[model samples]
Target: MIDVAELRIGTSGWRYPPWRGDFYPRGLVQRRELEYLSSRMNSAEINGSFYSLQRPERYRAWVEQTPDDFVFAVKGGRFITHLKQLRDVETPLANFFASGVLALGRKLGPILWQLPPRLAFDAERVEAFFKLLPRTSHAAAELAKRHDDKLKAEPHTDPSPRRKLRHAVEVRHPSFAEPESLDLFRKHGIALVVADTAGKFPYIDEMTSEEFAYVRLHGDEELYVSGYSDKALEKWARKIKGWGRDTYVYFDNDVKVEAPKNAIALAELLA
Candidate 1:
């Protein structure tokens, strides 16, 4: 585990009701959850963006609430991946960029795009979507300027003051396992997500980018409801150590309030 690159461990989302008493202190207000969790964990994924667009104020508040070292991985909207199937999504992509995501500022980590199970591998379509993504924060903010009226108020199209705009794609279909998909990632410098879905989805741990790696742990023994056992955590710690690259690991198994506990445990193991 020595000489390995920086490792970040955290949960997918912080606003789960089930975690109130276990992960979060009892009687803690909902608004303070991120503040409390960020003190213990180093990073997390903003799951809300996957469902709908969020305002810049929220992103600013998130950045203000967390510590300086805390980073957030923003989930790309499903409109681009599922509904539109990555076709003619230029506006949607622009809207996403304009939707105050850059407000995360230096706290922003990577943007994650998770595809549905039904969508199979289409190199042309995938490549098009990948090419549309902006590599640097300045480029993303520049693209955000083309956002439509959906944003309503002033958008956070400011240039990124921190790292480059990194993107990670997670495909559930088996077809993406093909080698060609890997090529597309290399060409675009996109990281292939290493998702552990308890066999419910496709698993691709391949590192297509040298910049960083992303891993989503949906569950171990069960989907969403189960927690990682000691042996399971050890296995993952060893594997993560072998990566030797900046890695962000997010636990998606929050159904039973295990995501936070498991994430903290894994973080300790890596530490």
Candidate 2:
């Protein structure tokens, strides 16, 4: 069984002003920022790869800067998962892992495959993609769509290459909050990726399965794009403490300000 207590949480990624100088110097500053942020939080999701391909040397440098227990949850390359929407991108995926990003060992968390809102559930595509993944201990899937009848009736299958890989599903549509959808996730043993968006949308309020709990707090819509708030961080911390399993919380809110500040506060709450 998965131990939820071992879970860690933080923001989806970190960022800095572009006026900071060249990418190298900016990266150096970012490293210092991450070090200070990680000092508080147990883990963070690296969203940078979504913008561009990650170099192995850069991944190695990231490993060198953080604490031993710091886990980096990386978002898969956007071209393969978002733009191309292919089930499998063998060469690119291989290059990514072999590039030293996944070399972090226990420091590596889950590989987030965030499908674009336009990409609906394609069983064949999803099946093919899962087959190509390495049997790592940590892996997850996120779908940013509304749970529809078609997606519901379709057979729920696990095509992941490894038995130990954990699957986490996220639904942005209201249909997913229904009892049937929740039951489906629990039946398949897929953990729900609870997202903190705006308004009265149905966020995952309870653990649907025994698997680890994965959450991405995108912050209030107004604050999300901007990223700063102590009140929100405190509220999220309270929510984390209520979970029974290891929880992964990421602040996908305004990265410019809140990512680092909330990361520090949330870490203190967890600690």
What Cα-based lDDT does every candidate model obtain?
A: 0.90, 0.60
At residue 184, give the lDDT of candidate 2. 61
Candidate 2: what lDDT?
0.60
In candidate 2, position 27 carries an lDDT of 41
lDDT of 1 by residue, 1-73 (tens): 3455567899999998888888889999999999999989999999999999999998999999999989999
Q: Where does model 2 exceed 4 Å of error?
A: 1-4, 18-31, 137-190, 199-209, 226-235
Cα lDDT tens digits for candidate 2, 1-271: 2324576767666555631342224445644866765666678888787666665566667778789988887776777776677654765554445444544555667667665656655545555665565544333121211112322122212223333445455655555556666666676566667777664344557586575777876666543655545676667777766666677777766544565456556767567
Output the TM-score of candidate 1.
0.97
Best by TM-score: 1
What's the true lDDT of residue 265 in model 1? Answer: 95
> What is the alpha-carbon lDDT of model 1 when measured against the actual structure?
0.90
Per-residue lDDT, model 2, residue 58, is: 68
- The C-alpha RMSD in Å for every predicted model, in order, reads 1.1, 9.1
Clashing pairs in 1: none
